[model samples]
Target: MKMTRIFVAALAALGLSGIAWASTAGQREAEHFHWHNAGPFGTFDREAVQRGLQIYQEVCSSCHSLDLIHFRNLGEAGGPFESAEFPNANDNAIVMQIAAGYMIEDGPDDAGDMFERPGVPSDAFPSPFANPQQARGSNGGALPPDLSLIIKARHHGQDYVHSLLLGFNEEVPADVHVAPGKHYNPYFPGGVIAMAPPLFEGSVTYADGTEATMEQMSEDIVTFLTWASDPHMEARKQMGVMVLLYLFIFAILVYIAYRQIWAKVKH
Candidate 1:
């Protein structure tokens, strides 16, 4: 009984410590947004994803890099560039054209010098800067992080992304000090962000003619980022459904067999 009491006291202390730690983490609660890619049966919107891609290419791509994504991923099944004519994403003409637009660094030649060539469908998205120093140098000494897995990296994931993008330009509190190059965004931790207001009312012209409101852009970009973070999420959810159905049916069959076997027995 004494040991149990001690254990309980220890747990209470640990819980209090956890609360203190959470308070010190500096994370502000993000505003919630309805995501089509959320929940069990949720699927990505092709047009929204495509529009998000356009936004990334036109604006975010100037500083942020999506190092993990390849051009061909757009044309893959369930992706934005899905094409009935070209099932094989690697061979998709649109993907090839997009990749060809960028010049990638190739291997050293016979003279031991690197060469540049047009990128291919399989090539990863190229970084905006050559190195970390260059990236930071160009951006007022703030390194723009790669957006490849940002959706997974951030807490509250999708909601956080949407809020941060749309929460800019708010009135700064008297106590809060925003740096010269920084901007005020309540959704960001500590209520400040190095990135300026990226999304505007008329930022990029949507290809599908969707109104380019701040909220719409924010939602679209978050969808694309979520998909980029976990391209196989939909497939995994589908497989999970199949497995559950199989197990449920198997359990029913087993229960029926048990009843039949026990019926012939005495209790």
Candidate 2:
């Protein structure tokens, strides 16, 4: 009898927890957006990726860190800044120029002291905050996640990121209570986010003269991040296609040989 009562109480508690979770966990589904790199034959749009890089430098870099990326990656084949003339990423002048813009920290000389130096193609991107504690302290106790693999990290990653960027709602729903320093985004779980709306119109003047609309910026940044997450996607897809074609031809040849060998021996 005691075991039965305990079971019943536990079930009731679970039911109440489920109900509470259902109430607060209503998040809008991410809207789908057509990507240039969606299909097997798809390739990333270089222009959009370049623009996205600009957006990251101008805005996102202030909070988020792309810890996994290096400046040399920009000059690699199929990268946003790839140039036919520069076969080696380290030797690419444009990449070198971009790297030079950032200051990097280097280690101890004979004097045994750390020092700052100009960034190089081989250097990993610098974090805006020195540590996690500093990052959290600046952003109301929320650490801005590294954007390096963000596209691959989230569910429905591409769409979710794009929608979340555009999903911030100024008019809060009556039932939802937004806490101090938090913003309402329907796409975010629990419908609340610590990072406020980051993109705005005219956030950055595009060098290529593209209008910096909120939607455009969101799409561009997502594209850049997608590339960052999978820099070798195009090469991988190409290899897959070649392998499939080779297998198909090999299978056909084997079938032909089998038919020839069994011509006189009928089962």
Candidate 3:
């Protein structure tokens, strides 16, 4: 009973550091933010969102909450991920699957008696505690934030996520309190955040045998957050491509028109 209580207390403490704290990605060191320089999947695989999603589920999701997103949106992030398995994800179903970890009450809705989480699209995932005060009292006053649009709302978008994931460093003083865990960065929008550095060098062992270095993991996770920030990435990419195609066609027509108009003149 004692051990069970301790474990429960620990989780409750972690939960107390409720979601709401966020650090801007671009706010980190200039070099690290270069993850943006990696370019799109064509330039560098931004599609690692699956990999990043895996990282978020394995590490960050336990404490943070993406209350705004539904489990079904993962696979739909890009045109479907090519592989059947993501390193951290058991099956391709990771996208549509909900976290089975904690369950809380969400009050009555259309279903009448109330619903359970990770609830279907029809339900909202319940918080670990009834309210923020409960969370803060246990968590040393930290609150996690909704991660749905973090990438978009912040500057440099995806680049920022990449930098922040790998940027946690205790030696930097800003992150001293996090020790082996969370850290602080002067660049984070709020100037301080409760999240510890969840990813570290060789922290996770991938099933497919990729190096588990911090940089790789950071890149992967940022990709996922980028997608989560905008579930319609594929739609945006398609729109960009169409716009470029239209501009190219328009340019050709304009050139033709110019030649016709200038045909009678010679220099």
Backbone collisions counted per model: 0, 0, 18
Cα lDDT tens digits, model 3, 23-119, are: 4443544344554323222222544655666677677766666777654444343423533455323233543355344464666987688765543
Candidate 2 per-residue C-alpha lDDT over 145-224 given as tens digits, one digit per residue, 9 for 90 to 100: 99999997777779989999998855789999999899999999888999989988899999999988988999999999
For model 3, what is the alpha-carbon lDDT of residue 54?
64
What is residue 131's positional error in candidate 2, in angstroms? 1.0
Ranking by lDDT: 2, 1, 3
* lDDT leader: 2
What's the TM for model 2? 0.89
How far is 143's C-alpha from truth in model 1 (Å)?
1.8
TM-score preference between candidates 1 and 3, better one: 1
Q: Give lDDT for model 3.
A: 0.57
Task: Residues 127-225, candidate 1: write the lDDT tens digits.
Answer: 999999999999899999999999978877898889889888678899889889988888888987889999999899998899999989988888888
TM-score of each: 0.88, 0.89, 0.62
Query: For candidate 1, what is the lDDT?
Result: 0.83
